[model samples]
Target: MTTALHLAKSDDLPKLSALVAAFHAESGIEISDEARTNGLAPLLNGIPHGAAYLLGPARAPVGYVIVSFGWSVEFGGMDGFVDELYLRPAVRGRGIATEVLLALPKALAEAGMKAIHLEVAADNATAQSLYERTGFRTRDGYRLMTRVL
Candidate 1:
């Protein structure tokens, strides 16, 4: 089945929050509602730092994706990292995520994004394969390291 991505707006917080909570729970990411809302609100409000999209029907979205932006000297311009991507359990294996990944970068590139990045668990071969098919490759010896601010 085909899917559509609606650029999320401030009014979309409630629905987007629900989807985000579901994704965090399913993925074992522990976070409070306030934190989630705090993180999501700015993006939905049009912060240049990132953007969010609702997948499927806007009023009753089945999933969501968020991409955060930053300058990358190696990439030579603005680059984006896929902060989160999730679809409801019922919609798994339908190529919906693949379609979103493919289409999202095209739009971002048009908006001057030089590269897009996402992290898949080392053991998640399924997601790795999906990412590979959609044109994401490992950075040879480079690994993503993070520190909580």
Candidate 2:
């Protein structure tokens, strides 16, 4: 499937929110509506901290991707974390996500991002395999650890 990505704008909030809510519910993530709004609003409003992209079509996107930026001396410069990526159930396994994964990194790299990262559930072998094919690899002796503030 050939799809395009649109950088989400503030006006796209309602559509983005609906898609995010669907993704969260499907993935068993339990976040409140307010939290979701708080997180997505900044990205949509052109905050340098991150960006949200609507996949497929602006009017009715098939999926969405959220990428957050951070300075990483270890990586020699800016790095991006793919905070969220989701495709509607009807679109999964059609290479749409793979295309995004492949294309997004190159775009980021061109924009001076040194590296990109994403976390997948340990048991989700299918996702891991796809990520690997798209050039992601497990780092030996390192694990992602996070604490909510």
Candidate 3:
């Protein structure tokens, strides 16, 4: 039932980092708090490269989402990638994510974001189907390639 995405602030870092830690652990990502803090602090401090949002009450968020901005000549303007999304296990399948996915991108688009993109595990059909419901189409013949610097 939680559908609001409160933009994060520097003062919220401790709580937000805990949520990110939980999400990373659940996803099998081995990350240190120092690393997490380093990454999140800039965004929270208004660095413009990305953003994080608490999904639900600001004091007791049920989940969080991170979005990183980009520019695409192909898309003709600014775009964004859903860098990460996480919901507490107790809250899955209740259509909270569905509501967020459906509403967030539209809100972003209205704010002049040309497009929003997300990556799903090739095997996570449920997530894929969920994203597809929100009008995210798989780019035919294209796979996301990345190099970690």
- Candidate 1 per-residue lDDT, tens place, 53-139, comes to 999998899999999999999989999999999999999899999999899999999999999999999999999999999999999
Better of 2 and 3 by TM-score: 2
Estimate TM-scores for all models: 0.97, 0.97, 0.96
Candidate 1 Cα lDDT to native: 0.95
Please give the lDDT score at residue 118 for candidate 1.
92
Q: Estimate the overall C-alpha local distance difference test score of candidate 3.
A: 0.90
lDDT of 3 by residue, 1-149 (tens): 34888999999898889889998998899988899999999999999899998898889988988999999999989999999999999989988889888888888889889989999999999999999987999999999999999
Q: How close is candidate 1 to the true structure, as a TM-score?
A: 0.97
Kindly provide the TM-score of model 3 when superposed on the true structure, using C-alpha atoms. Answer: 0.96
**Full ranking by lDDT:** 1, 2, 3
lDDT of each: 0.95, 0.94, 0.90
Model 2: per-residue lDDT, tens digit, 1-149?
A: 36798999999999999999999999899999999999999998889999999999779999999999999999999999999999999989889999999999999999999999999999999999999999999999999999988
- Which portions of model 3 show Cα errors greater than 4 Å? none
